[model samples]
Target chain A: MITPSPALPIAVPLVAAAFLAGLRKFLRRWLADLIATATAAANLWLCTALLRASWHSNIVYWFGNWFPRGRMVVGIGFEVDPVGAGLATLACLLTLLGFIYSWRITDSGRDLFQPLMLIFMAAMCGFAMTADLFNLFVFFELMSTAAFALCGLKTHEPAPLQGAFNFAVTNTVGAFLILTGIALVYAVTGALNMAQIGFLLGSRHDLLVIAAAAFLCSGFLIKAAIAPFHFWLPDAHSVAPTPVCVLFSGLMVELGAFAVLRMTSVMFGQSLLQPHSAFRATLLLLGSLTVVWGGLMCFAEHHLKRVLAFSTISHGGAMLLGVAIGTPAAITGWLTYLFAHAMAKAGLFFTAGILLHRLQSMSEPQLFKRGRPLRFTAVLWLLGGIALAALPPFGLSNGEDLIESATHAHAIHLWVTLMFFFTSAMTGAAVFRVGMRVFFGLGDAGPADRAAKIDEAPDGPEEQHHIPARMFLPAALCIALSAAPAYIPGFGRWFFNAAHRFLAQSLYIARIYAQPVHYVLPPAPHSDLGSTLMHGAIAVVCALLLASWAVFHLALPRGFRGATHLEGPMFPLRKLQSGHPGDYVVWCMVGFVLLGGCLFLLP
Target chain B: MNQIVHIFPYLVAGWVFLCGLYGIATSRHLVHTVISLAVVQTSTYVLLLNIGFRTGGAAPVFADISPGITTVDPIVQALMLTDVVVEATVMALLLAMVVKAYEKAGTLSPDDLRLMRG
Candidate 1:
């Protein structure tokens, strides 16, 4: 039997997208969606096959058979390790689910959504698998261009235009930043292949390298929605169609963290693997700040999608923390957390889409007491929240366990534990508060926040009586799968093995050069399940208390409640997210300089 | 003079990048913002081309040159070409958004597009 080529996952969707776009006017809606859905499924199958093939070892596929001549790479390569392939697989799965969810939901554009979604999927798959630095930039631009177009899919709305514009500008700037970093690295190493560059620049710490690291990290952190660089995310999420928001929060933002992990491991692993490297410290500090900032703002938001958007930011911060730790166990935790978060977050967005479809609004106050009949959706929403809270028996709990156990010997263990608890609780509180207020009608309607005033047209026909099975199936499957890893029995052992190989830089270089791959696998790190469960339980209880406090604040005594409201103190922080693209650009510049200076001067 | 020539192009690229960002942050019109973004992208072209430049290098045209002839790095030029295409696409899309925002909101000023302010 002929094995499926690695490039098929990217090429199939792109070719289908072009075919669909060219013949859009002649094709009927069902035919277009059928072709897109089939293409997505085919891509998923191919990626899954690639994942299985790469499970034992990395699959290095050089285009046109131009293998690296000795140490020099002549052709672009797709290095498909299980981690990268798994990410590509997840992208395909989400895109397929997105297509299914949007089958009947009509947008204003004529047959444009499917093509854009296809291109977006292809770009993400390419980004996940490509090993060339310039190739990564090309795929990054392709992804951003597709995302900007998708965000502005609803040009009829003024807010979407503004949102898409900010997204385009900031992300375009980010792409340029990445390009600059790539240029700097190329200037020094004279190669665009990541493995070659890493081989050439081994253990050489210098000014240029520091600057490149800064630009690259900041560029991707912007994409990942870290604080100060995260202004575009909520704006984009607040206006983009529901199905698009699922991809945005589910995998795209997490891909930024994935890129950072990939870049550091392949390019700067030797220097950064130092015990007290300032680079890791800087990343850790930023991760903690992002968790706190994103969590607090998440709880303060009134818009449903924006709430989820901030939750994405908080969870992204947690992933960055895992990557920042840079242990095999930490990497495993990051991969697990990423998978669980993608599913649960997509499920939450799907449930929000359902509410928007039925109720014609995304404002928590507007949706208050109106979601009484969506009991199934309510259950999905709360289950997704529990996943976000890292409750036991969920994949998120396992991910958190692995990360904490990996860092137990470190001096910063307490700090990591606290950030995890705070972010999970805060984000969970935000979602739970919304679910209780909307589904159970436990609280009276509060005044709408400023975010509620933003206009958001529902993606589907409003006032729908019944949720379609297509829409509900994907969300249900997502929530179910988010809990699958915990029950899979040997999932941690298997994943830790894959992640150990992923973090093994020598094995990666060896694979690219077609040298005999001889590397002994380290024993997988063990999770302290007891400590993790205790912490997870506390986080869940804290989330419940916080949600209850926010929902029934009016009935509670003022003396007992203290002098602050959950949403009140967040006013100063919220002002930084002003919708002006100019202000956002200014902040992006500040972030670049600050991050560059830190990375340069720290060590 | 040699030192100045060696570093001149890099300095110019950095200056142009900063200027573009400054224009974006201070621009009054949305059209200007899009143009500023293009200007920012132009710096990458300058940087890439400058990196590939040699003192007496020829254009990277293999059809006419001998096998061992000195030529600029073809890869950076190729990268610059891709960058230009990406810039044009982004600019076109941003310009379209500017037009739509103007049509829907009746204004082009970022200050007036306050519909999404937190």
Candidate 2:
């Protein structure tokens, strides 16, 4: 499975897509699905190989074996660090799951769907591993194009077109800003390879450099669904077919965070030396805002998919916060959170898909008492919610344990701790609210709502009893995968070391300059009994709060929707999510301006 | 003065980029907004081309160049070419999406598409 070069992961799927496309004219449906699975599996295997090769050092693959000119890296290269390999592998694994989740739906366009997913997978992995800035742009665009089409896949449905249009417009705008930024970076160095550009930059604190960095990150901020640039995410996720949502919510948005971290650490490493304080403060503010805003929105949202989308934003915020901390521990926590959230969120979305397929409605009130009988899915949903809530034994909590330690170490403990607790509680409570209301009919029957009575379950008891294996199986497997990591011996320590090495910019730069890294394996997790207990207590308390809220919901007065009062107080913030493309564009431009000012004027 | 001249195109690119954003924020129709997006995308073309420009440089064509003549940055031009292609493709995709939205919603104004909300 391991190859001599890092490019194998990218090349396999890129080639396989063309191969699949050629065979598409004559191939049957299952055959196309099989090819897609094979291709995804191979890419996954190669990613493991790449991770193995890059454990200690960076592996740079030059195109056509182009030799460097003296100290300059004249040729474009594909650099695979362990973090990159991990992310690349995550994309492959998610694609494989997404493919399997939809295997039973072999309609006429199934061939097209599988190939697009493959290309999307290729572009994502390619972006994760590429060393050249321009090539990164290319891969990003390819990924976005595939995502846009996939969002619009259900074209006959009125909502999807609207969603995809907003997605395309906002993302295209972000893309242009980043392209301009890349051109400016190239302007300064005449170098496309990121390491060479870093060397050329050499600690320059010029205005152009600041602008380029801001612009570069602004685009990714949009992609990451960071607040103010996050308008399109909910719409897109709500309308896109659920399988695609798994990829979009789980991996695609995370790539945006990956991009921001990559550019800062690898390309702008020197520029950050002087402006570190200002940069850190700005990012911390933005990250906190994203978490708070996203959590509050998720708490208020009623639509199931939209609620999940908001949760993704909130988790993205947490991930961004971890990256903004920019410590080895923080990065370690981010990796853990990213891995766990992807698995749990994907599973949650699959369950939502099943809700749509079986009940034909996405409304929470509509599904009340309808899903009551499906105890297995209800348990899966709650378990996933608990994992998402960062329960003590879950991977998310372990990530939180590491991150809260980072905050304490960095002396931002009080603010980050409060925000982290609030955000997680709110998001967890939102999911808890939905699970109880829809699955168990815990809430009051409000005004005898029409949606409450419109259950469209299959007529016969036998048919009603039938659960789609495709949906339930994938959900269970993904949830189990996410949960397994938390208890896996040494997983945390392994992740910690990978992250430490990832944050070691000078080492990465040296490796790119073809220097040996002298890799050292980090010691496995040890007892920090006090901090572990504290974090566990916080998680347990949050879980307790959610549980009590559900119990209290069951005790509430009839015909009352209790939380409508919560939004009344936050009307201004609610209005901020205007759902207009123009408004979203304004937010992005404003965010870009703020980002530039933060870089140029602050500190 | 010479430095300002050298930096002139980037200043223009910034202005054009802001204008495009302004247009998108104010525009009523989706088609017009996408065109404004295209205009913003054009700023990147200018930026890349200007970045690669030399004061007294020849093209990167090898046949007619003398031994030590400075050629403008060919790599950036290559980058710009790729950018144009991507721009074209994205525009096509956006326009297609616009058409679909128009057909389905019977409206091209973004203000009317406020269905999803917090």
**How many residue pairs clash in each candidate at the backbone level?**
0, 0
After TM-score superposition, the amount by which residue A198's alpha carbon in candidate 2 deviates from its true location, in angstroms, is: 1.6
CA lDDT, candidate 2, residue A140: 92
Off by over 4 Å in 1: A562-564
Task: Give one digit per residue, the lDDT tens place, for model 2 in A407-501.
Answer: 77456877777766766677777777778777887754222221122222211122234666877888998888776665788787778878887
lDDT of 2 at A424: 69
Check candidate 2 and list the clashing pairs: none
Give the worst 10-residue stretch by lDDT in candidate 2 chain A. Answer: A451-460
Highest-lDDT candidate: 1
Query: For residues B1-118, what per-residue lDDT tens digits would candidate 2 score against the true structure?
Result: 9989987998999899888888888888989988999889888888888888887889999897786899898898899889889888888988888887788789988887656544
For model 1, what is the error of residue A4's alpha carbon versus the real structure, in angstroms, after optimal superposition? 1.1
- Candidate with maximal TM-score: 1
